[model samples]
Target chain A: MTRRWIRWLPAIAVPAVIAAGVLIVPLSANAAVDLPAKTPQQVLEMVATTSVDAFSGTVVQTADLGLPELPQIGQTAGSGSNAPGTDSGQTASIAAALEFLTGTHTARVFVDGPTKTRLQVMDSLAERDLVHNGSNVWLYDSAKNAATRVTLPQGDATVPNDGSTTIQTPAEMADRLLASVGPSTTVTVGDNTRVAGRPVYDLVLTPKSADTLVGSVSIGVDSETGLPLQVLVRARGQQSPAFRIAFSDVTLTAPSAGLFDFTPPAGATVTQQALPQSNSATGHATMPAAPPTVTGTGWDTVVSLPAGQGTSTMLDSPMLAQVTTSVSGGRLLSTSLLNVYLSQDGRVFAGAVPLSVLQSAATGR
Target chain B: MLGALAAIPVLIAIAVRVTSGSSSGRGPAFLDQITQNGLFVALTAMVVSTPLFLPLTVGVVAGDTISGEASHGTLRYLLAAPAGRVRLLVVKFVGAAVFCLSAAGSVVLAGILIGAILFPVGPVTLLSGDTVGPVESIGRLALVASYVAVSLLGLSAIGLFISTLTDVPVGAMAATVVLAVTAQVLGALPQLDWLHPWLFTNYWLGFADLLRQPIAWDSFGSNAVLQLGYIVVFGALAYSRFTTKDVLS
Candidate 1:
């Protein structure tokens, strides 16, 4: 019996070794040893100085804003009247924005220099491609088979100033988070790791303010390339991430020029428009736009938009009153990621923190 | 049986192309990626087969490994040939695992051949939206196929254990299949979610992470660990039971 058991050892040993080889080692084999180390400040400085001429990759974004069960944003757009307790267009836009922020989406992003960028958000069996080639920008919606082309005025037009298009990427979010890292944030360096097989270092920024719900944000920057790999945002009192966007794969080669060229598909509707030009030449700074004022610094930063621009009348709307609860001197609408304060004095305050932060900013606290 | 089973992926690929223009509800996670390149045919083949067809084929083959010989009265002859009971059991388990790989491999091979001819074969747009060359895509497909084959290790071991108990091959086969389905059913229950990580099928779909741009290793790594755990435990149980059991045949 002992001899029989000994014969069986080879079978067990071989498979055991094979299993261990395939299952165990490779999981942690991602990062190589003998990599250089850098402080968080150095990493950030390196990231800020590095410039990417052109590249393309896939990005996945997930947002968990502590939102309640919302109606499917896709089918709810024009069909809002079909559902009770749904305001037609106003609430739908907010719901759409919320839906856009929350769920996981796979987007194909191509950047050929800063001036030429293309982003295509993939949907089931369809896609939406946003192509900006110099002064000519095209937004192609395959679901609707509609393409909108906007021509920029000469060289100085920021034609794609629309909020939704610009803030969709992890790199863009990293820029915003890093820009906010001044006196209000405590920056530290994390351990070295790998992203897309490139050595990367994590720069962690923690907000010193206690009034906000934001805990900290960690940015993964490729050590050699200085490109941002991932961005993770965790709210206060939560161990898990509240929002994250990262590349599952990436290539740093310059994209082909033809990728930026856009032509509307056959039988697709096309709309053309011209954007207002930025006038440093005009000398008046154009329309005398009211600057966005921030009342608090760092994590508790509450940004208030100028009041009495038809926004005050929006506060009295029945739909707005139905969804929001009357706070101290304002109507408060809260979601997991953002809090909006509509003060009775016609001020609009928004932040990722809390309603109190927004209220304080409204009251100039 | 293997030949017939291998043809399923090719047939599914044809069916997918036939219904490409029509809505088939939500088919899989990366339908756009699949539609972009025919190479993903192998991925779609494996994805569709893992939950039911592949496991079913695995159960039948593994279930027959020992019981078929016993039912045919060849088990005693084989053992009398100086092949110890333990050695014979090990060989049977290894044979079953090879069949699992070949069965899935045949699907992949057929998918590549048929898919290359039918659909546009080019750089695959990964789930992460990064484009990988055809050769690299093939490598990823090989990885996916192998990972899938490895994922069935637990089921194969369990089936082998069931084979040792019964002399009827069909009964053992049916029992193994039922157990797989039962594990899946239990895994699906929200109340029994705690049992999901322990279930062999829990990480079957974890291969999706492999297609990410940077390749998320956590889920796929956990899958292998869990499957390895199942293999060790069930393999030991099979060894213990077969060693002291009476062989009337």
Candidate 2:
């Protein structure tokens, strides 16, 4: 018996070694190590005080919004002068834009102070980059070989206002979650974790209101640098996260100045268009016009615009028809990250909460 | 195999160039934007061909290697010639491997010709948003072609073994294609993700890693090793089965 077993050992050993070679993938390079814990308030204070800005990293944004099927973006006209108010076209563009926002996308991000930032979203062989350097902003889509340059209003960069549609980074997202830390929420220290190979402390915030569908929002703040490495959001009753944005790899050193510089690649189709000028006397460049109004605030906030506002040409698109279904009083497109309700009453309501939350807002407001 | 090597590349080159030239309106989402680059066209041709066309050709060639001789009553005569079963199987495997490499090489050659004529050849932009010089891009294309060809070794071995079991070439060929498609289908299912790494076709698309700036060796290395594993195990199985079998045909 011993001799027979020895004969088979070589075969078994070879396969076992090969299997190990294929299966062993480390989850994170930063192994779990002992780190000091801090209170939730201390974590929030650290986030507010963190000065490690002007860094570059690769971020992956994933939205699980419980979507039935991810919408496929078909042939889009290769021009940024696209009309924004047309019905079906707008809907198609919105749907296509939303598609880019949902999937697990890898983006290279660079932040050089508050006014200068650059993000390049990589899609297969194509790239879409957004660079905001002071007042001059450029959005370039290499897939279309098209570039759109817009100059923001002179003082728009200094204004402390909301409703602007500038691309949101992980730090801004952490700030948004932290700013909502008020009387309607309870904060606590959750776990000592590692993010992007850096030791971090998680601060968990739970909404006090039962009317809100948000279960909890946790921000992982780097212990030493105080920069938020990740922000995760989960809706009520869901086990997995609905939306997550995290740096897979990050560095605190300031990125180079040329990284934010933009010169369209040779042969790219350039469309020079100034943003809608504010009503000021000079009538110079202004911030892109803000989208429709939002009713209510905090976790239950509902952003509603006219039904045909940005649905553009996609209103009657068969592609749109395929991904969304009509519900009781509206057409509901649900993904793991957020739900959008387009009602027959000629209004589109969208929120991070559930359809029920949107419905309540639709009825109440 | 020679016929495939001669005919398939020209056919694929013409087809890819024509489709790329005319599909300006609403063709594939990305290829239209990159129509100006020949290297991209060649890369596109390889990607378009790998899933079905190349595999079909490989299946037929591998499937016919042994069974075609048996169906013609040549197996016994060949066995009588003192070229033992193990040696005979090895020769057949070498022939099938040569076919796989040359067939893939033919497509790459055709793509290069068409791309050079129909589009501009210059520094190529990789999927990672970094650009590599023309020489490096060609090297990456060669790497991609090699990876694709090597990835099919497991399929070749499987088809050769199946061919040994049957005297009808068509039946063996059909079995090989069906099994290849089945592995692909299983790999596509999200619920069966755990089974993917073990599947023969799982790492077939790992050639895309060559298009990355730094060249992601993680997937590329695993894929090469996995296919090697498949070749060794299946090659041994074929040797064991053929050596003990009776020459009844």
Candidate 3:
């Protein structure tokens, strides 16, 4: 009996060893990082003057915006429609937008120089790629077997502002947030942390006013490269971050030039598009009937859209009705950090504030 | 057994050939691509078989390892023939592992053969929407087969342990297959989200990562580690049970 028991020892001992290793490995990897301290101004300067570029990385974006989960109506419904004013088209667009704001998405980003960049959004059993090689830009969606090609005018360096390229990297998001820093924001240096296995300094930004739903925003700047590796935004009273975009893995070396060169494969529906003229040249033609207007400033800013931009049709969407509650003025779509109020008059007011604030804005009080 | 496994892709290729084309995104992943590039037949077959057929066959072969010998009253004779108990166990486990590899290999080989005959063979479009030449596509398919084979190692180890627990071969086979199905069912339940990463079946379909432009090896690495854990634990369990139990037959 003793011999039999001895033979069975490995079954218990092996699993115990594995369990302990799993617990200890992560703890050791997260051992407190130590880095030389820098003031907020120095870090801001570091971000503003950083010259490092031409890198490849895998980015992960996760959002827990406190929105109810909607049924996954496949990409077909949204991609098939071109008219944004029609009922199905509006509903499909809203559902697609909400879908983008809810789930965790992984994208591979490859950049070489200023003009050659590729973003590949990895989806389950499908993929979407936007490749910009100098003046040539190609957008390919595997699920739809569709490709769109755009040739930029000579000497134009900017990629076409198509809706397909909305998923931005941490660097892009951090640049936009840093541009808004002023007296209304309190910028401070937090503890040194590690992101994507590299030492980084955490620069924390907090809104001074309590009126804004945003509690704080933290940016992880790589110590060696001064590039923003991660951006985390927390909503007031929320323990976890409301939205996070970070590079899970990054390599500083430039990606191969072949990655930027894209050709629409056979059987794909390829559409050749001419780049839209610059906004300064044709600003009025591209503007909506009544362009959205902004009120307030800093984090409490509210964007109001007039009655004719399909706000009423969006409210009529069954998918939208499922998530929004009927408020006194109209329907209110509320998230952890953002609120949208659709007034009975078909005007829409949206802000990173409470529904009451959106209501007041909608009433033009 | 490999012939039976090989017939699956053959049947699929013929079916798709007869139908001329499958609507994209409607059926098994890569099913629509089979008509365009013959290489997709292998990928489609692997995806369809990974969930059920592969595991079922693996369970049968692995579960019959020791129990079938014991049930036939040959295990005691073999032991008395100077083949040490541990050596016999290791040999049996290795035999089952080889079956796992050949099973995946046969499906891929038959798929390519039948697909080449039935459809136009040319550049293959990866899941990332990038196209690769026929040679690279075949190489990717091989990697996918290897991934699927590695995925089954854990299940084979579990089946071997279950086989050691019983003298009835059929009972062991049934129990092993049932456990595989149970793991998959539990994995599908969102309520047990925390238990997902531990399940062996969690990454069975993750071979699609190999089809991406810049292959995502994260799933492959995680799946290997998870399977290695299962192998070590279950191999130890099978060792303890097989060595401790008396050969009464």
Writing each residue's lDDT as its tens digit, candidate 3 over B1-249 gives 788889899999999988899766577667877888888899889988988899999999999999999999998998998878889989999999999999999999999999898888999887666889999989989998999999999999999999999899999999999999999999776456579999999999889888888898988999999999999999999999899988877
Candidate with top DockQ is: 3
- What CAPRI-style quality would you assign to candidate 3? medium
Residue A248 lDDT in candidate 3: 94
| Candidates' chain B TM-scores in the order shown | 0.94, 0.90, 0.98
Model 1, runs deviating above 4 Å: A1-41, A51-112, A115-170, A188-202, A246-298, A303-337, A340-349, A358-365, B1-50, B71-73, B84-154, B161-249
**DockQ of every model listed?**
0.08, 0.15, 0.55
Q: What lDDT score belongs to each candidate, Candidate 1 first?
A: 0.71, 0.70, 0.85
C-alpha displacement of A286 in model 1, angstroms? 27
lDDT of 2 by residue, B1-249 (tens): 545544544555466566655443244433553456776666766766777878899999999988888888888998999878778998999999988898777777777776777678887765534457889988888887888889889999889878877889999999999989999889766556468878999877667666754454656777877778877766765665566556667
CA displacement after TM-score superposition, residue A323 of candidate 3 (Å): 2.4
> Where does model 2 sit among the CAPRI classes?
incorrect
TM-score on alpha carbons, each prediction: 0.62, 0.74, 0.93
Pairs in steric clash, model 1: A65-A336, A248-B213, A248-B214, A249-B213, A249-B214
lDDT, candidate 3, equals 0.85
Best-first order by DockQ: 3, 2, 1
Candidate 1 lDDT by residue in tens digits, A1-365: 88667645654775577667766766765545446777777898888987876788878876666554344334323322323233344444344445565555667788878788888765433456688898898876544445778787677535463323333566777887887678988999877776656677888888887777778888889787788888988888776688888886787898778778776643356877555532221211211257767766767767787776446656766655765788899788776556888888777888877776676566663
Q: Please list all clashing residue pairs in model 3, or write none if there are none.
A: none
